[model samples]
Target: MSEAVLETRDLNKNFGALQVSRNINFRLDAGARHALIGPNGAGKTTFVNLLTGVLSPTDGAVLLNGRDITHMRQDRRVKAGIARTFQINTLFAGLTVLENLYLAVSEHLGRAGAMFRPAGARREVVDEAMAALDGLRLADDAGKTIRELPYGRQRLVEIAIALALKPKVLLLDEPAAGVPSAESHLILDVIEALPEDIAVLIIEHDMDVVFRFAREITVLVQGGILASGPPDEIAANAEVRSVYLGEGTHD
Candidate 1:
């Protein structure tokens, strides 16, 4: 097995009297495709936020490639090779696709900010952005603004932006959410095509997306692990079925 790219060691989080996240131990190996799924209030988002440093844990650590990064800020985490896409598309609606991706590249390089100048004018940045977009089969839409593209394409752009950072770990929070079923496959294909060295951790409600994309599944309920195993084992587990899967048709 590969060394873990991202992990939480006995992590916990709370808001005053409300304890939303429990002591959670999770691991994602290099190149591993894994899913984190549960009921709506399962604290999945909180865990993602904690892992990405959007929210600090009340206790425990977040490790990146065997290094402790539990106290690092979100931007530092990005530079350290952790990137994530939100449940909502966070893009500059007026900016062209190329421009948006360039923002990612430039940010990763710690060069000019997206507002300072046209990143496309920077040879190195544009070159990197173009390469990423091309891989997603979205090169032709490079000139289109974020608002002009369909939801699916925008979702792809989100991944492309994350890719621009050259991250060693990618956390995708509902990459296919809000996309039409017809176009959702584009999101999955893009994810499937990513290089195998970057660990991928996805949180999805769509069983089709989860089962198809993840080799291993971790079921979380109330911020704790309900079960963790291969897809077959998760599918056959009675506890997971009753608590999460719930008789849904699965592939």
Candidate 2:
């Protein structure tokens, strides 16, 4: 088998006395699209935090492509090819869409230090920013401030920022949350079109999107993995039914 693009070895985390993630042994190969799902407080978010360095694990290690990166800083993780979007929208609400993309391009280009540099001086950056917007079919809105866009458009901006990083492994924390049913189709399309070379791990509650996009599913319950496999297997797991599905409908 190919090496895992991302792996967690016996990962564990705690919030005070409550263990929120326990022995999160998992791996994603390059090009895999994986989904993580469970009821609220199941420790899904906590597990992602450990992987991304937002929260250190109480025990265990996070490995990126065969290298240990458990203690790496968040920025270092980003530079190492891990990029993520938040559950809530994260963007420069006051800036135009192109300007927001410019910031992302700047981060990728190592120009974040040159605050005095004119945004117009970077032709390559501008070109890349435009290309990213075009790929998302948001080229027409490039000049509009994020706050002026619809809520769904603003969410797309956040994703565009992460895409600018050229991530080898992308972590999307609930990209469909709070989006209108109509607008969610846009988000789903964008996700479906992401580069096939990149591994995608998504933590989302929307079963429709999860089942539609993810090739494999991992279910967590109270800080532990209850079941994992293709969606069909996960849905039929008795433990998953008793702990998570619990009378909820399934596709």
Candidate 3:
């Protein structure tokens, strides 16, 4: 079994009297394909923000490979091998795919601001960017602007840019949102094809995508864990069925 590379221990979060996340403990092992799902006001977004260091928890610790990082800064978390994508596409619409990827790769390599880098380093950065695009099956459109691509492909490019960060853990937030059914296959393919060394967590409301992508699922309701287990078990869970699966979740 793989070791738990990312974890939260008895975590809690509050906005004044609103307790959004409470006493939450979660773990993600190497190459773990985990999903977090719930209804509209379930605090799912709050919990994820805490995990990514975008928001501080009221209590408990965030750990990476057993090291405590409860107070780590956002950029530091990224450098520590945690990366995430949002529900919406955040790519530079005017930039070509290659340019976009090159920026991320260069930033990861610490050559983003180098006005005079050796030719060898530049070549390496270019190669890394190309590899990331190729991995996403997006090499053919490397020269195309983000505006020229479909929403789904743009989403994949965002993920590819995250991959360029060479993260050990990846968190994807609603990757298939706004994507047409026809184009969703592309996103699903790239997500499933991600490297096995990276632990991945997905936050999505699309039942079809979530049920198909996650081996294990975590159900959240009113700031607490309702159920967590394998896909079949989650599907069979009584509370999940009555509260979320029946109405809120969708294909």
C-alpha lDDT of all candidate models, in order: 0.89, 0.89, 0.90
lDDT of 1 by residue, 7-87 (tens): 899998999978888889999998989999998889998999998899999999999988999999889998999899999
Off by over 4 Å in 3: 116-121, 249-251
- Tens digits of per-residue lDDT, candidate 2, 1-251, equal 66699999999998899899999899988998899999998988788788889999989999998999999999999999999998888788899999999988888988877878786697888999998898888899999999999999888888888898899999999998889998999999999999999999999888788889999899988898888899989878888887777746643
Candidate 2 weakest lDDT stretch, 10 residues:
242-251
TM-score of each model, in listed order: 0.94, 0.95, 0.92
- Per-residue lDDT of 145-225 in model 3, one digit per residue for the tens? 999998888999989998999999999988888999999888898888888889999999888889888988999999999
What TM-score should be assigned to candidate 3? 0.92
